[model samples]
Target: MTDTSCIEIPEESSSEKVQQIDLLYKCISKLKEADRVLITLVLDEKPYEQIAEITGITENNLRVKIHRIKKELTEIFHKYARL
Candidate 1:
């Protein structure tokens, strides 16, 4: 016998989600075109191998680039969020 239970997931209000998404897009827009493309692919949940192939960069370089891009995006997001 197995007991089944439903776990409740907290949901953000649609308006709040929309605002956050708008802020994220604004942050992404501030990035260079190449960075924007790479981040977009990453956000789309593309695998690292496919991203590397698509961007013509090695996996190691891709990882480093992603780290930098995320750091930059976070800064940008925080800057705008503070306003």
Candidate 2:
């Protein structure tokens, strides 16, 4: 028998997802170029070491930056989400 336990399901409808994506992109666009690149790399699932090498930063710094970027992105996303 096939294992279905690992399968994931989405709670949002297609249109809601599209709208959320649109809002996310809008928020991302407002970020600085470096922040945009960093966030994109994270979203792409690049390893921390690789991301640090590419960004020329230490792993600890990268983690801190990622945390801050996410916080900023959340704020931006919420600001746009209300509109």
List clashing residue pairs in candidate 1.
none
Cα lDDT of model 2 by residue, 1-83, tens digit = 99999999868998999988988888999999999999999999999999999989999999999999999999998888787
**How does candidate 2 fare on TM-score?**
0.84
Worst 10 residues of 2 by lDDT: 74-83
**Who wins the TM-score comparison?**
1
C-alpha lDDT values of all predictions: 0.98, 0.93
Best by lDDT: 1
User: Over 4 Å off in model 2, which ranges?
Assistant: 1-10
lDDT of 1 at 1: 58
